[model samples]
Target: MPNVVLLLAALAFAGCDVFESSEPVAFTRIALPARPVLVNGTTVVRGDYQLSAFTRSVNDSLISVPTIDFDRQTVLGVFYGGSFHAGCRGNVETIEGIRLAGDALIVEVGPLPDLGPCRAIVYPSDMVVVNARATSVRFVGAVPQ
Candidate 1:
């Protein structure tokens, strides 16, 4: 009788642990400025943009490896041309990473090993801004002097 009661109590506790609620997680969205910034000679375009930042979550299960998934989020930045579109290969001194998100494209500068080759987007009205950190860049529409 005592063992049965203990087992029931343990099950109840486990159930509570499984059913417990957690606070909602929030992620900050950063908008690319209207002005383009140049970092390390690489030009980044600024506009309403979205990119994938990789992350993983695990579930409690046995006899199976943890599954990996991707979460898609939107980031505002200028659209930069892609290497495939530009017909270029290898490291291009200015561009670093190019990714397609929805209808917009993202061109990232600095160290992004995961992202493939990048190409600068050239628009007749596009303006460029240089980054002081030398690690980031952005492209945007014309900025008022």
Candidate 2:
């Protein structure tokens, strides 16, 4: 009887949410966007902002979600439950938005955001911000597993 009780207890512990992953399994096989792959300095305007693809990096199997704040002059390459803050190397005057646009990374720029120091990260992923004078920046970079 004690043996059966022990097995039940073990099963209960294994069934806890803590033992499960928070992110979806699809993230492991997610592919990088392709628009940034065709970056040629062409400007794509939306609303009142102008967008451009200046740099990109792609991951093999690892998933890296891109996050940027022109207001804070910061970009986060998030993956494996950790946000690797790095991207943009120039003066970020303003930012309208940063998100994935159908496998493509799109950034919308406004007049200008506050000026601040640029942070760059190279490990596990690569990110960068180019042309402080430009209004927008796009990335097709990937974060491998």
Candidate 3:
């Protein structure tokens, strides 16, 4: 039994790839729905996702969230209307860690700035915020931006 354990450990250690990557991972922008929120099976942006920032500038509070969209279901808009980046979070910053593995789209979102200084905006047109990064996102395809 102990010999088997030692053999497994040795194999795992030998499989480590120290030279796997040498470049910074870029989180490519994903194509999402104009109304991409999915509550149960219906599309609706609720909870923390129900947010808005008036100006699409760095001065605005960062909308740091994981986005989930339908590949064939959510109607893809040719033009994206809003802008929210880590630059907007002032002292704090956010990064939507969008990744592509095989056909999966992974998003690892950092923390967001406090909503105190943020001037509240309504949903729909004003709701041009990024989907706050959830625990995990299961997706496919890629749109580098």
Candidate 4:
């Protein structure tokens, strides 16, 4: 009898929306060419991806390119163009979560990680594939200004 009561209580809480978690958006890490000179900012690729800030030919091949179905998907790119000195080595931007807040879609990114001092040039970048189209997409948390 006690076991049945406990199971019912657990199921009730699990069905509650207050305890629901946001669905994570799918993403992939793209490798940029050696010493890639890219503009520092967020870039959204919609329709045709022919943006000058994102197009480059490395070894006669395109780098950081992803196949997309523009009819139902969108690509969001986060790039840290400026090189960071020692102290902040291995700094990179990571997409943490993507969820709907009110009527807008919010993309969350992890903050810069604190690491030991090391002499290395770090250029953090990420490519995220959003599954749904939104009237407005807003990026929040840890995005390079």
Best by lDDT: 4
Q: Kindly list the per-residue Cα lDDT of model 3 for residues 56-92, writing each as its tens digit.
A: 3223444343454422211111111233322212222
Going through the candidates in the order shown, the clash numbers are 17, 18, 6, 0
**For model 4, how does the per-residue alpha-carbon lDDT over 20-127 read when each residue is reduced to its tens digit?**
455555665555555444445676766664433355421324565566677777777776656453444333547677885444567887775654565556566666
Give the 10-residue window scoring lowest on summed lDDT in candidate 1: 50-59
- Put the candidates in TM-score order, highest first: 4, 3, 1, 2
| Candidate 4, residue 131: lDDT | 72
Q: Per-residue alpha-carbon lDDT of model 2 for 1-145, expressed as tens digits?
A: 9999999999998888555432111111112232222211223323212212222232222323233334433232222113342443222223333554333345433432222344653122223332122244353333222
Give RMSD to native, each candidate.
Answer: 19.7, 17.2, 13.0, 7.2
TM-scores of the models, in the given order?
A: 0.19, 0.19, 0.27, 0.62
Clashing pairs in 4: none
- Candidate 1 structure lDDT: 0.29
Ranked by TM-score, the better of candidates 2 and 4 is 4
Poorest 10 consecutive residues of model 4 by lDDT?
A: 51-60
Clashes of 4: 0
The lDDT values for all models are: 0.29, 0.32, 0.31, 0.62
Candidate 1 residue lDDT tens string, 57-111: 1111221212211223322222232322222222222223344433334344333
lDDT of 4: 0.62
Off by over 4 Å in 4: 1-24, 51-53, 57-61, 83-93, 101-103, 114-118
| Higher-scoring candidate on TM-score, 3 or 4 | 4
- Where's the lowest-lDDT run of ten residues in candidate 3? 72-81
